[model samples]
Target: MSTALPSAVLGAAAHQARITLVRKYTSAAGVSTVVVSLAVLVLLWFVRDVQLGAAQVGAGGYIFSGFLAFGVIAAAVLGVAGELQAEREDGTLLRAKAVPHGMTGHLVAKLLAAPVDALVPVLPALVGAALLLPDSMPQDVASWVLLVLVFGLGVLTMLPWGAVLGSVFRTMIGLAWAMMSMYALAALSGVFYPVGGWPAPLQWVAQLSPLYWIGVAVRSVLLPEGAAAAEIGGEFRLELALVVLLAWAVAGLFIAPVLLRRMARRQSGSAVQAARERVLAKGY
Candidate 1:
């Protein structure tokens, strides 16, 4: 019985992942978003020579790192939120709630699929940087390993919060506001420029966010040792960054399941019907 349950859960998760990927890639809006994201990434790569006054090197490495981190974080948060909201409206979540350990299977599917979903948008940028700016790419096996670790930690740090946001925000407007907040944080987090150059208060606020730490970790892996001079405090405080990311991951792990269960419990036929009506009325 124990083995059967585990097998069933894995099977369900795989099935869910296949469905999510098909729906995401085959949709017109999804294709458009991917194209736009690819364009922006290429644009940034071309402009990487731009430099800040306090930086020791051109912004190329930072731009690459920032792009990588931003992609993963945004995928974990915004991507999950938008998809979950859609699923709820379309009765997908309600259907999952009906099956044995369905929500668990769904969550497992997200855990398996979100990273792949995140990568589709980022792979082009990764390839572009490697071919066009080889110096910024990780040259050693150790650095490559570190890059993987940082990326995984970043996903862990943000994925649960994405679930929370999706569960809490029932309306598109609410989700839009949440997305705007993420953009605001990205601006402050030095995705496009050096955080050290920001005002002290803004710098502090940026540091408080997981996005900034993810950027820090990425930069540490991809940039040369001397490149640390351009970072806040003129050094990479990787230990601090690790702690911050771990803290977020731990907190999110605790909070996300509770909120998800609560959200799942509230799912009903009437709620799904109302959500569909609202979506239809909005012409979305």
Candidate 2:
């Protein structure tokens, strides 16, 4: 017998699905990863004094940590990959395929969950950075809010790509390689230092990196008045951090769905069996 779901029921179901996904992905292991990453930052703070004027330091501390937001997004990638791989292995995906709106509901739920999972670690890291490094924190409440919004948007931009990666590489070994490459690229892309200081070719490479743009946008809001503004040449106005971030978000939105659809179509029993065997042999 067919029964039509009421609008309210549908909405509630969707909301519940999203919350469940967020909780599933935002586990203790994910929190531990965030803590370790923050610990590294704290050690850095202890090693060298990041001098920004009183106001600048405060803002810089908040903005500078924006790159760490990438870690949160990376978690989303891991979640998607892990979820899909596990489901494929267990034949849960086939069961989901039987539902009327199963695939759409699942993806939407995951998409909603990604940001929450990404932000779970950021809140504590931000608080710790603020309390430990008071001088390098933003004093302005409005600026802090703006920083959060901007940083969140930046993280959102990466989710689609993460989704795409997860869908493509439905195995832990594949995911590990992708994650390592992302981290290596981010490190080399001037997240913590000036890329301009690198060799000319490397500098050019940094220009093409998304991490560079994210770092630049963060520094622009956090750095003091006299410090080199996060500009192309110190003259061009760069109020479009949000815009650049949005551009990436739009690209990901389009590409992710297409990639996921392709992955869904190609899913097979042999692939699932192999994935399960691998997982059982090596726990991710």
Assess each prediction's global lDDT (C-alpha) against the native: 0.83, 0.64
lDDT of 2 by residue, 45-143 (tens): 663364544334443353445445455445555556667666666776665566666666667666666666666656666666666666445679977
TM-score of 1: 0.90
By TM-score, the best candidate is 1
All candidates: CA RMSD (Å): 2.5, 4.5
| Candidate 2 clash pair list | 57-136, 58-136, 58-137, 58-138
* Tens-digit per-residue lDDT, 249-283, candidate 1: 99999999999999999999999988888878886
Query: TM-scores, in order shown?
Result: 0.90, 0.78
In model 2, the worst 10-residue window by lDDT is 229-238
